[model samples]
Target: MRYSPNHKLETKEKLLESSSVSAKKSGFATVGVDGLMKAIGLSGGAFYSHFSSKDELFAAIVERELCQSLARLGGHGEQDCARLERCLKHYLSMAHVEQPESGCALPALGAEIARSDILVRQQAEIWICRLQESWARILDSDSLAWAILSQCIGALVVARMLATADIQRTVLQSSQEEIGRQIAGRQQAICK
Candidate 1:
């Protein structure tokens, strides 16, 4: 039975959406196509109709994940720099760590991205560059931008591993406050 082109596209989107969420939660390598399709009320046969191979689907999922990861960055403007800092602070907080599904793909799937294929790596690089561009606006120097970005990534990665809510919150608060204080110092240095 042939479905309309729209229906076919919708089915494909459903597959991508489901797979992305599952990958973010359980790691990309662990989410099987068959299982994902089954969860979305489709069969393995239909999976091929939408995707050439798992690698192709993974690239698509990575792109989707990347978009989701950056959606909170908002538009760049005169005020965007401040907004971006707050957005990053919010993202790296304990609230985000406690809720994986709603946060950036990095904390949820960074390790998996490291292990993924070249295509996924390329996609991740594109996302990172875009983020750097966003971050560069608020920061004065390239080195400062890289430093803050790395600190945010590392803090989130470490914060996610703590066993208790209090410990996790403490980690997030300390890391964020320390980063903020450093940014303040750097900004002051830039003016002097």
Candidate 2:
């Protein structure tokens, strides 16, 4: 049966969406093409139709996930401090940590990307730079933005590794407060 171009496009989008969420929730390397295809009600052979290889699919997923994450967390039009604060609150919350599939891609899949091919890693680098620039604009200091980004990503990674919810919350709360203090300190200096 020959599917229309629109139908094929729709199917491909569905596969990308589902595969992205699954990869974020569980490391991309761990999700097999067969299982990902099955999740979207497509045969394993259909995977090749959308992507030449798993690496290609992974590159696409990285690009999609990172763009979505930036839109959600980058705080496009809000004031600088407010945007930074909002991002910190949402990113460091227990809810974000608990729902890896729907959360930021950095903490969820950073390790896997580090091990992936140049194409995938390049995609990750592009998004990371975009995020840093977004934060830098709000924070008014590229150094501080880099620090906050590093801290936020590291905190999430550590929080997720802990055994208990209480520990995870502690890690998140501490990082959030610390970042907040840094921002506040900078603002105060600017006001003085």
Candidate 3:
């Protein structure tokens, strides 16, 4: 059977997409190479054809996920404070909390990213910083941007750790409220 030249690139793209979802839904370390390949309807050995090693695949996933996160939370250009507010609301909602697989990769895979090699972590940091910068530009305070970003990610982590939906909702609501206050206060301070 003959395959188009794009077939290899297309297969790698599919593998990355499937593996990323699996890694975020579960832990990256928990899912083996064979499992990742199987998720994309490929054999374990075929994984080597796409990636030199599992670590390489992980690096790719980090880049892909973070790029997505940047696009979602970070406005393309000329974003306003209102857009940032809407983003914070959506990011801290129950839907995001319940859907780890489809949600932000940071809260889902932060621990794994922390444990990975320097290269992977460096890639994550770049995207994270871009997100922070986007928020900072809109908020007009770098520290405020960092605080809200950390709180949002931490809120998701804490909310997911709990067993009950009500308590999870409480955590998310409190964080959002506090963040809203912070933003409002910043605006008031600017007016004063």
Candidate 4:
């Protein structure tokens, strides 16, 4: 059988996509290479053809996930406060908290990434900075961006940790309101 010139690239992309979802749904360290390959209908042996090792796959996943996240929540050059508000609302919503497979990778896999090897950690740091920069540009304050990003990620983590829906909602709602107030206060001060 003959494969197209882009077949290898396409297969790798499919693997990355499938692995990313699995990693977000279950921690990267918990999902073995065989399981990830099987998720995409590929044999375990074929995994080595795509990635040199599990750590390499993990680093790739971090890069891909963070890029997708930034594009989704970064507002794409939007400088208005409304962009920030929308990002916060969507990021802090129950849907995002409950759906790990399709939601932001940070809250889903942040701790694992932190404990990962230098390569994986570096990839995460690079993408996280891009996310923070997007928020900073929108809010017109670097410090505000860091604060908001930290709060949103932390809220999502805490909300997911709790067993009850009510407590989760409370955490998300409170963070959203408090972060909104802080952004508004910053905007007001800038206008003064």
Q: Which candidate achieves the best lDDT against the true structure?
A: 3
lDDT of each: 0.76, 0.89, 0.92, 0.90
TM-score of every candidate relative to the true structure: 0.90, 0.95, 0.97, 0.96
Residues 60-117 of candidate 4: C-alpha lDDT, one tens digit per residue = 9999999998888787784578767987898999999889899999999999999999
Model 1 has a clash total of: 0
Q: Give the Cα error of residue 1 in candidate 2, in Å.
A: 5.0
lDDT of 2 by residue, 70-171 (tens): 887677757579666986898999988899998888899899999998988999999889988888887778999899999999999999999899999999
Compared with the true structure, what per-residue lDDT tens digits does model 3 show for residues 1-192?
Answer: 999989999999999999888888888999888899888888899989989999999999999999999999999778877778888899998999888889899999999999999999999999999999999888889999999999999999999999999999999999989998999998888788
By TM-score, the best candidate is 3
**Measured by C-alpha RMSD in angstroms, how accurate is candidate 4?**
1.0
| Steric collisions counted per model | 0, 0, 0, 0
Reference-based lDDT, residue 69, model 1: 62
Q: State, as a TM-score between 0 and 1, how close model 1 is to the true structure.
A: 0.90
Q: By TM-score, rank the candidates, best first.
A: 3, 4, 2, 1
For candidate 4, give the lDDT of residue 18: 90
In Å, residue 71's CA in model 3 sits off its true spot by: 0.3
Q: For model 1, how big is the CA root-mean-square deviation?
A: 1.9
Tell me how far the alpha carbon of residue 159 in candidate 4 is from the true structure, in angstroms, after superposition: 0.4
The lowest-lDDT stretch of 10 consecutive residues in candidate 4 is 75-84
